[model samples]
Target: MAGRLVLDGGTVVTMDGVRTEYASGHVVVENGRIAAVGPGPAPAVDGAQVVDVRGCVVTPGLVNTHHHLYQWVTRGLAVDATLFEWLTTLYPVWGCIDEETVGAAATAGLGWLARTGCTTTMDHHYVFPADGGDVLGAEVEAARVVGLRFMLTRGSMDLGRSAGGLPPDHVVEGIDQILGATSEAVDRFHDPSADSMLRVGVAPCSPFSVTTQLLTEAASLARDKGVRLHTHLAETLDEDTFCRERFGCGPVDYMASLGWLGDDVWFGHGVHLDDSAIALMAATGTGVAHCPSSNARLGAGIARLRDLKDAGVPVGLGVDGAASNEASSLLEEARHALLFARARGGPQALTVRDALEVATIGGARVLGWDEQIGSLEVGKQGDVAVWRVDTLAHVDIVDRVAALVLGDRPPLELLLVAGEPVVERDRLVRVDEQQVTDASREAGRRLLVKAGVAG
Candidate 1:
């Protein structure tokens, strides 16, 4: 059911185990898997589509490990607020989202990520309005229409303002309702095949927004169904204080006591984790999705990424909520990771290659997809991103690999997922880009009016 194609003559950055770089290379794709990769034209095949990428830089397609796809509609609204203030201000507004709003936001967000060279994205959608019917389904359909691999987290929040959580009551659901709906959605959507285009995970939004009972039950359910677990942890001192005050232990200890430290679990924006917490993560093989932009934007402190990596913790990059980062560009997110790491730990903190690794292989590992989509290996999925730097910004750059992270990134020249071209020449081919833009704007306007944030 898959086609044959060849991307010939480019600077291939194969993020394999050895981190191979090919100055002038060709990658052959057959039946949705990488057939061969070497430093020349591929062997001739019958009816194969050959694409010339002579002056381009071809790398494994970028992976985004964590995001709140529905927050695109609320960008620029809570710019100056800290994490708590921002969530408090936006919770009431998010309470107004319906299926259409969620769908439009997911479509726009996925399109933006694709435009920036992402082939796989994991969305954490937790804000379920009381009457928001099938919000998870809406996002799944949007991902289908956008033509990228989708990993949707059936995120839930059970603690509300009345119960001392930040989100408004209307946006949070009862424990029974959340669990039932989450299991139902997982049964209806999760695909466990190696080449599955869709996969579903269970995520209880965060420690502050959920109850201990809910967390335990969600973890139990995820283990029962053989799915993954995700949540936000240790993003701020306030969260640490909340954990100490509420649970009489640190966030890591709280999670460990609940049996949440393992390879099948990952936490987002792990900014405030201490040395002990980092050690725990490394010991249990738990992963971290480092959202530098969102953390900096919300005044959350820098994550100890260098320390975590040195301790053998799986660290990945995330764009987080568009409302926090304001851009869903995985390349730019990589750049930010580099910049923030240097700002925090000095010039030797993170290199361009390190940042790029977090965006590619690191992300794949975080999402438990390392074997299939992270590298351009002979038997891996045919997901590649091509960027041309022949323009003025890259004219005199001797090290093109550094240019991808240090300089202005050129728009993606081409993107392929499983031998299927979804973006070519910086345009999304599966759907009208302008139409998705317009629909998202309309949805934002309607949400603004409903939340009474409109001018």
Candidate 2:
């Protein structure tokens, strides 16, 4: 059985239908579901674990649609290179990953995300040393231990440099082995219910790392199991050239050939999608995870986010791989979405509302969980994050919604996942922060040594 709680009297910003925002509002939680939310109190708060967030901005816990949390140990090594070069610079180090390194980095990353007011995150773990033990299970346990909603993508790479792919051969797997392990993990871990805290996605890394047969088979297997599909698509001009030259089609058409366009499908980066790709995604109700910070870091062009959103494609936010983005705060990453889109398309291209929306509900939609965890409403999961208005935009308090967009961040105050507070006063409660930090630092050192990048 779950516990009950009540968050009383805060500025509730429900990015539900119509992008509603209310000042001095009350939200109640019972058994991990938001029992009631409105301007005033209900009968539910009588004996609940009452938390008064008087000066806080209570909003739906932000969602992160894509990340490589273990890549935290690979940061600062892949700089000043395009996507292919960057992958070359880092894959060897990643090929050395073990359960301990993956678990520590993932746990630390999730802890940081929770303290940054993100309660849910989707990790796109594409590294498979084949020798690395239970990479998926390691990350799942890390997320659970860190107390965040976990969508672990059972990702694979079946083609390598020897076979004209990006990753080295040591990191790629046999197609049969990949599919078997993926199917087994889905059966063993994926929960289909609306109330399930954990779900699994089937991802085949990217076009440059896997064969077409593997992509098609992965998509077919994903459809057979009724799970979501994810992959990296069109993040760089080099990738665009690769698609046009190799496949005689763009990324979207190639995906369509694999039966990979639907509401259950989400492609990361999506920086190089053309008008046709945008139309196909919108028509098929496909989702995209926009990696704004990673695009900026890798010198990949900014994604046409406003165009995609305006075209009716479901858009969400992603931190991408830490090796590329190097930063993990999605709320802070939301600011990058605003800045980058504006840098390319001018200020009106993507509004702050749209940026924040992509981080929360839009991300939920991409992950196929909008109905359960995206908004603050009755019968939805009570995953809430309280962002203090006093951070740097005190004057913008007149406009709370604008403050989230334009104001500087106050420290994250309380982060609740299913009505359980995992971060309070910006401190993690699930694991000793010091222990995780020390473990991660050691792992980072080891990752560099494994690559011979450092002694």
Candidate 3:
């Protein structure tokens, strides 16, 4: 139970049903939920902590729909390779991760995301090494240390190189092992409450990395457990070719045949979808986690973001893994999403507000959490971000939202999840940043040495 808090005199952008914007407003929070939101000063309340955010932009804390937090230790590897080439080169190294390395990497990754104004993030972790002891538990503990809302999708890869999959045989698990572990993980971590700090989902790696039986059974398991489903789909030309050769159809059609499209499902990297695929997704209420930076980094094609938006598809922003997108900043994802959309579809492809929406409400929708945390409403949880727009990097911009989405990344004044401060004055509240960085560097060295890639 958090006490009362008041954020006064900031430009409030409520990404609600009406897209309301308050020029100067006050938001009062009580008992971990929004108590009031309106223009001008807040009503005086005794013993309330007041934060003067006169030059800041107050909005819902950013939601990251997709990520690979364990890849934090593998940043800057295979920099010039395509997706398949990159995966082949890194799988051997990733096969050496343990609970210690994963914990350190997740700490660094979650800390960085909090600094970049992300309040909630979902991690798709599929690489389960044979010797890796409780990797999922390690990351969940890391999230607790960083004090951010986390969703862990127990991702599985059952297809190996022997079976024509992308990953090597050493990194793949058996179907029974994968399903049992996924069920256990959900029972241990998932919280269905409106103000839950942690949740769990079921995710198979991708179309090319898993067998049809695994996909079908995983979907069935997720549905039976009442959890969401996620997987990579249509990410590259190579993926399309592989699916066409192996499954006798495109990636979208193959997944559709296995009953993997619905409001309870979201796919990462829907970059190679055609018009018919887009219509199918829209009709089925499936969502997309658009990772523009990773796609550009790996030379994957640009996703049809404008078309997805126009067709009423749920879409969200993602920074993806640090291995491909080394920056891994959710705020920068908004800028990249805007620039990439325009580069592909001209200047009118996306607006600044549109990018912000995808980062906030749009992402919440993808995670099936919009009713609680996506907007600055009276009854929603108090998950908010205060970006310092009065700084030198953003001071010149007239529109605060544009400054946030188009200009350079501004310092985060504050970030709150469930009314508790996770970041304050550009620093993490619960953990030491320098310590996290040092641990991550050590973890990276240890993993590379274990894999015989470094001495």
Candidate 4:
């Protein structure tokens, strides 16, 4: 077991049930769990490694509920295109990616997420080229190297353009192959322990890219394995149109018919949900991962975040894929969530604390891991993010949460996952960032070249 560590003299925001906060406090961590947290200095421990975070604001480490880590290598392409156009333009390039490229991309993406104060992240990787040897294994290894709590949804797409889907035929897989591989991924990777660092979910890409059989069967498979289910829904108007024309209903109702709405299920985007959809999601305990920046990037309408929250629907923040939202910082997503919510429903829509909650406990709830993570409560995992708010960009902001959500992104002084330091002093502790960046760049070039899109 690792030795005990104490973070002393920081403003502690314990996002517990009652939303506790301490102006000047300390947190004691032992055996990979939070032992204590309260006002003033922590009780003295004989052999504890104490970190003085006097000028910092310590909060629960941010949780990113949705992302496509493989897209790190595919950024800056189809920038001006719509969602459908973008996918069409890049599907071929993504199909050329093998295990090596995926590993590089995942490593780079996870390292960057660490530097940005994320201790837990979920990756939705749907593209699996036939020759892409163990792409899932490669990303799992990347998460291990980066030392973050990871939930990898083995996403699949079996509906090709031949079946009126968005992806090319070559990128789509057979139903039998997808279900078999998804089950294998869950069996091989998912850990159901209270303190598990890794878990796998079953995700059948989206309604537009997957058939009814895959979605229904995937939900059943996830339930059988006692794991979670995830997929894209209501992400764009085009998807709404597709669902209406093809499935004869909106995305939410169609998913409901397949028995996909439950506490164990969470959908990405959800930007086009209406009053009825929101109500149904709330009633079913289904959650939504709100990707504010990505929605704006794709010119997709902003999600009814205020409505969802008011309706008691669990809403979490997500940075989405780097291919759409190039700035993949989870911290920035909190800012965007606040701004977008206010834009849609006036200044009273979302407060700074609300934004922070969405990035932390709300995400934890969406991922169904709030019992173990997402807050600084005693006995929870010691996943904490210490932001240096004493800097020039935030020193004047009296409210720590406001400083974090409203001011410029503060430098992350430290990021801890399960009492282990994943990032310290504003840099990654587990991997070399520069090397990861270079490898990711090379992977991008190799993929484009393989697709004959680059020299």
The collision pairs in model 3 are: none
| lDDT (tens digit, per residue) of candidate 4 on 1-455 | 26699999999999999999999999999999999999998899889999999989999999999999999998999999999999999999898989999999999999999988999999999999988999999999999999999999999999999989999999999999999999999999999899999999998999989999999999999999999999999999999999999989999999999999999999999999999999999999999999999999989989999899999999898999999989999999999999989988999999999999999999999999999999999999999999999999999998988999998989999999999999988989889888888899899999889999899
Q: How well does model 1 score by local distance difference test?
A: 0.91
Error of 3 at 86 (Å): 0.3
Candidate 2 whole-model C-alpha lDDT, 0 to 1 = 0.86
Better of 1 and 4 by lDDT: 4
TM-score per candidate = 0.98, 0.97, 0.99, 0.99
**Which run of 10 residues does model 1 get worst, by summed lDDT?**
394-403
Between prediction 1 and prediction 3, the one with superior TM-score is: 3
TM-score of 4: 0.99
Q: Per-residue lDDT for 1-455 in model 3, tens only?
A: 26999999999998989989998998899988899998998899788999999999999999999999999999998999999999999999999999999999999999999999999999999999888999999999999999889989999999999988989999999999999999999999999988898999999999888999999999999999999999999999999999999989999999999999999999999999999999999999999999999999999989999999999899998899899999999999999999999999999999999999999999999999999988999999899999999978989899999999999989999999889999999999899888998999999999999999898
Candidate 3 regions exceeding 4 Å error are none
The digit string of per-residue lDDT tens for model 1 on 59-177 reads: 99999998999999999987899999999989888999999999999999999999999999999989888788888889999999998999999999999889887787788899999
lDDT of 2 at 119: 84
Better of 1 and 2 by lDDT: 1
lDDT of 3 at 112: 94
